[model samples]
Target chain A: MKAFISKNKWTLLLLIAATALMLVLAQKTYYALIIALFGIYAIVATSLDVLFGYTGQISLGHAGLFAIGAYSSALLTIKFGVPSLLSLVLGSAITALIGALIAIPASKLVKHFLSLLMIAFGQIIYLIINSWTEVTGGSLGIMNIPYLNVFGFEVNSNLKGAIVIWVILAIVLLVKHRIIRSRVGNAFIAIRENTVAARGLGIDVQKYKVLAFAVSAAMTGLAGGLYAFLRGFISPETFNGTQSVLFMTMLLFGGITTLAGPVIGAIVLLLFKEVFQTFSTYQGLIYALFMLLVLFFFPNGIIGLYKSGKTAVMKLLSKRAEATRNGGAENAEN
Target chain B: MLKIDHVSMVFGGLTANNDVCAEVHKGEIFGLIGPNGAGKTTLFNVISGFYKPTAGKVIFNGEEIQGKLSNQIAQKGIARTYQNINLFKKMTVLENVLVGCHTQTRANIFDAIFNTKRSRAEHEEAIRRCREVLEFMGIGHLEDSLAGSLPYGDQRRLEIARALVSNPKLLLLDEPAAGMNLTEKDILTDTILKIRDLGYTVLIVEHNMKLVMKVCDRICVLNHGNKLAEGTPEEIQNNPDVIKAYLGGAK
Candidate 1:
């Protein structure tokens, strides 16, 4: 129990802080909804990190998977009268299956070809979502999606919705933490670092690659399901190829492999999106320039900058301590 | 035991290995030595399941494993190291070796996510074995360091440690002492001998004849994709064909 506490102290602290913030912002419905959206985006970005960051597989098709989750859940709740919670899980699972199917062929390709395949996948899904009038309601989209109901509690208010989403996000983060520290995560990193070496060590490179995709898709799908329930609507406009690119950008801007990087990236970028809402036309250009600046100055992302800054501070502190100690010794001798 | 039965690998018109046949006994340090382009590494690739030999069978423990995938071959108790160092550069030394334990561990994504009793046991067992192998390789102290950050010699040892943690019956080492100094080579020689003593049948492809001669129980000399000679170190030293093809007819 003590070991678990020590290992998960930071996670616990973060959860507490996020819950406190949510309670404080409970009266501000707009801000609460934005925080809920941040939670959703953070989940998607972290899932993308699992694929691109840990497994070294670039996927620009996550928005498609997200659409699948959102559409599946919305349809299940609206048409079939299924419970909201069950639909969310089933939707995520369905997306995971599709992700594994996509990975079967994608695993055979490398670099830009893989990226192209993922882009094509996202485009196809977007087109389907836009044109499938009977099911997806065409470009008009599906509306009046039910709010998430957890057993007896209805997450109708923005603050309650944010709390619930953040709770799910906490669970996702905890699960990700477990997997990353385990042998399965080790296999993913090995495959990323050196395929030949990983094979030599008896790791099934293709199997792990596909698994990464499936796991990533499952998490991203959950985020999509959450988004659908939170906003009570589903649309093709939100799950376009550009959104996929945005997910990747968030992963890169925060840091790829680290757990906290994606969350940080999602929150910061979402804040930027809100700040630049007035200049919507220039948002793309500004994001592109920001990404360029980040790539140049902090290639490893914001986490990398923080780490380096920490080390610099430590170095200066040690140097000052050493100089003072030497002066004290000289004075005593004199 | 491993038996390479008439194995041949041809890349288009280039015949890398032409009907090469050899037998490696249990718990013996077998050596394959040849000058440049002798198909020694090619033969290693064939046995390790990186390539489907054009013809012939690679039988490990009496099962034909030539056409199987590399990971499948590894599952059948065959583990190999590359000619170039292939340690996961960004991963810590412990993590690199832990990856070797993948074939032995049975924890899946569900197991890992839930931290089930089975997963916890497997993880602890893997770490225990990894630490043992790192200690055996004299790299226990450097387990937390990045594999890429290690010095060249230590990286080589870490690769061996990674291979060793798999607990394979047959260990295939391709040029283990490729870029080592004399002292490092001497240490490697001792490590190889220690590995052999640990009851693993080691098939090593090496250019360092001194290290090979000192540690190999039996050495096979290849020249231009053909077996030139096969014998103990003294017998290989005196064979006229081996002397002419490999030793340059000098000593």
Candidate 2:
């Protein structure tokens, strides 16, 4: 509806402008290489947003889905000689199936229990990747994973890869934005508010819960499919519990409730990671501290801060104008 | 349109509701009344499909829906409000009502993603219908305000608006006038009548006698999880058991 978009005009503008700026800036050498990876992570973070921000559920084992997607996509293409696009599709499908499987139990469990289930799921995937040596190459990881090619054109180069990834991000982001503005989005919010009330209003809470989780996993899996092609390698270490936490941190740092929050959060945190890889050992500690500070002061994330600032500025301007108008009116009456 | 036959709810060893039975015919405002802890709300939950009765059948429009999921019952054209307002606090009042439009609208993930013409039309219809409901409930101007930020009366009205937008065949109100003053109560009575006029069968559980007596076409009295009496408001007023149950002694 126009009302939905009209209300979110500023946010939509900011995201579109930022996205355009990022796509243009992402063509250079150092920028393109890492920014492509950032784009991949952005997709993952947004998917997590659908769970945590919209659905009011948490998945600490999303890294498991990510790993499954990456390994499946790469192995299918490299070993089974499956074509690239089909393998990617298959990977996403398998990840969605796994997501639904986890969701069956995960939907019935509340915050802590659900988180624990996902964490255990992530660890199980890690174990599988570690033990299934002949198939997965175990810790050695999959190598020579093909670059993304469509119809015969290679998009493996850094700039091309960045373009490819951002295109997917653009489409996915728009779709997510539209959904968050529609009936299903409101139903998701209703489920988040009060499950009993949502059900009384005729919303199937459990079904929507699983839907959120599955959609989140599907998004992360799509990113994983892209990541496999972009990096040309796969390892258990890349998708793990730590990575899942980072994804959540990204969602929180950007303002989880906002549509653009996860994407912006991903960009900001990923940029920091690339710029400060020299402190890679301390990244986890830094992330925790940053999240702590965000939780304490800006629980709504950067968007909240921006909104508050805008409100203050508008108030100040209005007050000053009123003061001058009153002064002029008094003088005129005198 | 609703029949509750020998419905009872037991939580562990505690019987929250004993065998309770009542019938709400089409095109009437049915009132459910009782003192505190009398299982009025428990009956509402059983009918709304929130709780599975320990023993009984809840037949709605000829379908046995005792153990069906709450949303399924809602989809069967039954919608209800809570004793405590269960609005989505952060969403706009309009958005809250749009959520009630979930069953009537069909926009799959692809439609949402692509912003298809059909989905867009549906979205517009949802907003338009939400506005109409808000106006009907006397809160059209509060559409953009967050549900949590509205005045107390507005919030209650907003809840009704949300319930009505779903086109419910049976709309159940849990203490719809719990915190209203004289004027708000009058307005609520009028609104309930209007809802009935629009072909909705309303069932209300309330402790507010003034509004209930003014609005309800038939009143069912419950005391200690059991039906004490059922009749028109004047007849209910003369019922000795209801007076004894409410005042702790008969006149």
C-alpha positional error of residue A285 in candidate 2 after TM-score superposition, expressed in Å:
1.1
- Looking at model 1, give its docking quality level: high
The reply for model 2, stretches above 4 Å from the true place, is A1-28
**Candidates 1 onward: DockQ, in order:** 0.88, 0.74
Q: Candidate 1 — which residues are off by over 4 angstroms? A: A1-19, B247-251
- Clashing pairs for predicted structure model 1, backbone only: none
Error of 2 at A209 (Å): 1.3
TM-score of each: 0.97, 0.94
lDDT of 1 at A120: 97
Interface RMSD of each: 0.8, 1.1
- The residue-by-residue lDDT of candidate 2 on A1-334, one tens digit each, is 8998999898789768976886687777677877788888889888888888888998888889999889888988998999998888889888888898889889999899989988999999999998899999999889999988877878868888888888888877887887777777877888888788788877888888888887888888889999998889888889767788888888888888776678778988888887898998887797898799789998988877778889999999999999999999999999
